[model samples]
Target chain A: MATHGKKQDNRSPADWWLFVLGFVLFAAVGFWATPAILYAEKPQPFQFSHKLHMEQVGEGCQSCHAFREDGSYTGIPSLEKCKECHGEEPMGETPEEKVFSKDYVAKNKPIPWQVYSKQPPCVFFSHAAHVANAGLECASCHGDHGDTEKLRTYEYNRLTGYSRDIWGWSLIPLDGPPKRMKMDDCAKCHRDNGVRDACFVCHK
Target chain B: MSSSASEMRFGMVIDVDKCTGCGACSVACMSENNVGVLPDETDKIRSITWLRVYQIDNGQPYPNTQIAFFPRPCQHCAGSQGHHTPCVSVCPATATDRDPKTGIVSQIPTRCIGCRYCVAACPYHARYFNWYDVPWPEGMDKPLSPFVAPRMRGVVEKCTFCFHRYQRAQNKAFTSGEAMGEMDYQTACTEACPSGAITFGDLNNPEHKVHELKKSPYAFRLLERLHTDTAVYYVSAREWVRRQADNYLSGEKLAKVQAGGGH
Candidate 1:
């Protein structure tokens, strides 16, 4: 055993330290530098809590988010939709509601809400296929964001400019909520469900 | 996979005799699909035309002069029983496919790798390769149809039979709780034809107008001998016009081809 161990130590002590240093540098870059370079933090237009809205309205998401007759998904609620409720005054005494009513609804201006799950222009996503045809819930891909009381900062890739949700949130990929919205995720889900799709099924 | 009894086979039947060669079909297709206009359209071969009208003549002089216009769409070829269409089978990326349910050859621009294999493989030259970036004029982007996404450079695009309209029609039918039929969905070219020459419908459906129109004695498909099994059929009463549909050998008489009753 001693002879075998000595034979294995064919390199100098300095060589061992250099190898250790290289590994440490690689791990630091991968664990730290990669995430910093890959993601960009941006603030949302306003603090909108879905949980609070759900509690107040006592309705599902489709009430605020409508699917058009043409099968197009009205992703973000239009300002006109907000005007329906906050026509005269703010829904709540909160600062966000006050700002929304005064700056947007009352002034007849549109609120530029930053969309977190926006896909690239090339990708053609059909909300009807997932929600109407497949009978999938909004939470399947979006996680419990609808139940979260506070608005989280939108994280996007610096290079591809895609949402962090597209690449999955965790760098280590521990397999949690907010599953990546990449094509691989779609393919895997389709495979699991045995839903055969042509290339034009989701693409145009 | 087992085919459903309600499977639709969408096809077009164009009456060449009624066509005035106005190029309305081509114009409508381009505008509807948001097909980019090239900076230099002088090079006809390089230019993109989802639905092109080719003028063919009998090569007669003066009084005997005869000319006919052929508006060629993608054809959505359903080659023989087992094989896929020529373009679809040759596509390395599987970007183009014939949807068995609808018999519509669908081209996915996003999945296209721009290899141009399918473009070359196409006999009708239906597929067009995007050589350069689409130069959208000032304020043109805003007017683009939301249903059809503008194709990026380095991809191939062909006639999609206005699939978005089908999706919309399907959605409308679903909402109304009504069954969608051939009349529910029609291509832009078919709708824009001033002469009402083009008849589009589910060829498989016995009740559809196209089913009756396709069986007309005057109907003939382009290059039928190649056995492309094109969905689009042309109808012309003129014997010379029928002869122009496909090639004939020196010994093969026109009477013999007519007896065969369109391949």
Candidate 2:
């Protein structure tokens, strides 16, 4: 009975540190594997520098991403808008511009640029309400995309087909838009702004 | 300027007398909402119809027979003062909600868990559960409206009063820095009615035709005694047609109670 009590008292101090180390190792693997398995990256049609375009344009983002006469946001400028500046020749000496001029411009095919912040088909996001009516800056929701030198790799969730940026880069989302674009972020903004956060407002 | 919940109450005043039961409203609603047409549409139980027309008749013999059509969409029930809309309250997943801004009940099919609690809770039988995925025939999907997402199977769906049109109108108004006009947003059924039986607009706006139409002596909502406080109002000049709007005890007369009208 005394030997048994001693054995119970000196059981290698329960190896509590080893248990914590095991937990940390598993958590590290989870953090690394979650993003790797869930997301698939695809390159944009061609790397385009928004910084260079921003320097050339007068009205900032609106110069290219303008709203239609009927108030609908023209998401990506069509080939016609690009044609207005660059005729049949390459505007810049960059290899990306040369490829754009030869493949998209010369061929008259629309560049299939993958949108990074594309919401699901169920969402009805109104740029008119947010930008025109509320007078919100473009940088409020979309980070420094307009001032970036090159387009970043577009990563999308395999299961939901949503952009990885929608869930944000971190496993645990601790920030709002410009980092995360979840429904909670939208609702938080709406709640803060005294706007109606009805389901039909955003969900058609 | 954006309208608030108290400022706008979008409702419909449908004139039952003028309706010819042509089913044009139903067809337009189906097409506008992208409601799926099953292969065997004759199977009424399986069909998904956002707006359904019901034929009611005065219980009279052949010579005295009179028939009228009631184009029934979702009542968009405002419920009572507490806003306990039957479907909205019973929706466990909050898949359905009555939008305070417009008094329009919205059903988010994606959020719906297919519990069918809302379907059962709705007194109007307006909600329908999609049993099958819509099989769009060759090239038929090309014309599908991009505004409203087509609902998948296992989700309860009902009439939205063509909310997408309202969104578009609001977008136009926001861009132009003006208020949404009375005619800016009209449901497809309202526009498609051959006899102009359906009138839709902000019931709160005096300038809108629906506001005046809803105040007519003949205006009565279906199952009014239930106190659903529905947005849709019906008008019929015929006494028997008005009587059919709600159930009454044998001795109770609609005319006697209607005299104390308070809708």
Tell me each candidate's TM-score.
Answer: 0.90, 0.94
- Please write out the lDDT profile of model 1 over residues B12-76, one tens digit for every residue: 99999999899999999999999988999988998999999999998899899999989999998
Which residue pairs collide in model 1, if any?
A: none
Top TM-score hit: 2
Q: How high is the lDDT of residue A130 in model 2?
A: 89
Q: lDDT tens string, model 2, B1-263?
A: 54433557898999999999999999999889888788889998778888999999998999999999999999998888665999988888888888877889999999999999888888789999998888989999988988999998888899999999998898899899887888989999999999999999988878989888888888888988888998898998898999998888898978765622336
lDDT of 1 by residue, A1-204 (tens): 355756656787999899999999999888887887778888887798899877766458887887887656789999888777677487678898887778887789988876777877656677766777667899987889789988888888888877787764654444433656767777778888987666666666
lDDT of 2 by residue, A1-204 (tens): 355655565546558788889999999998899889999998898999999999998999999998887889999999999998987788778999889999999999999989888888899999998898999999999978899998988999999888987875764547877778888889888988877656998997
Model 2 bad stretches (over 4 Å):
A1-19, B2-6, B81-83, B259-262
In candidate 2, the residue pairs with backbone N, CA or C atoms under 3 Å apart (3 or more residues apart, or in different chains) clash, namely none
- The true-versus-predicted C-alpha distance at residue A25 of model 1, in Å, is 2.0
TM-score of chain A of each: 0.86, 0.91
DockQ of 2: 0.70
